[model samples]
Target: MATDDSVHPEARGLEVVIRTAPMPADANGNGDIFGGWILSHMDIAAGVLAAKRAQGRVATVAIDAMTFLKPVYIGDLLSIYGEVVGVGRTSIKVRLETWVERQRRRDGSLTARQSMRVTEGTFVMVAIDEEGRPRVVPEA
Candidate 1:
């Protein structure tokens, strides 16, 4: 059975996730949104929080528990949200959740309310110094 929890939206404690529409350039020959595109968005969301916490530059060291629940099509609006799940000496784990919204029919009879949940990945980012070496994260 396919597990929906892989990209469960409620997993990440996000107040407001940003929404963006997928363009033709983002899709593959089959017209499905490329996984890389979604991952990049998640990284961007995570980076925003990571930079705020590190107070400097940060690099992605690892991604944990990533799974693609459904294929995304062009014109679909994507939403991604992230939360700082864990913090180490120099690393922070950000849990990200992604969702998609598609347009309904002209009659507004509920065309598609599908929640793909693209993936839930824990991004490990390390704080970096001016020289790019890992530095201790500041206390919250």
Candidate 2:
């Protein structure tokens, strides 16, 4: 067997944690959804899942480089899914994938929702106690 480098090679599976729509308020000056908005939602999704796995409170410690495959726009139904790629003593690494079902208007009529990959990222969350100290993750 070969040693695994930085990121783990295996992923348990992905589950949809959040489904939301980007509003006009979330749009950036370019008229597209702001990357920060999407990132914030992804972090929330990660925290929800991490807290459940940790059986308590958790905090986001790190995020790997993010790559946006497509742009997100208003009226798009965004779906955020996460998978547990790795679990350490006090940390749970989650991989988040964002897909969007976009609504496009053509000739003054709304088109069918088309789903496409928008962006993805990896977040490192640590289980914490009431005092905000790192704690061990409970076995599932």
Error of 1 at 93 (Å): 0.4
Mind giving the per-residue lDDT tens digits that candidate 1 earns over 26-109?
988878889998888888888887887888899988887677877777767788867787889999888777777766432335
Instruction: For candidate 2, report its TM-score.
Output: 0.85
Against the true structure, whose TM-score is highest?
A: 2
Mind giving the per-residue lDDT tens digits that candidate 2 earns over 2-53? 2222222223246889999988899987668999999999999999888888
lDDT of every predicted structure (CA atoms): 0.76, 0.82
The backbone clash count of each candidate, in order, is 0, 0
RMSD of 1: 4.0
Q: TM-score, each model?
A: 0.82, 0.85
The runs of at least 3 residues in candidate 2 whose Cα sits more than 4 Å from the true structure, single-residue gaps closed, are 1-13, 105-109
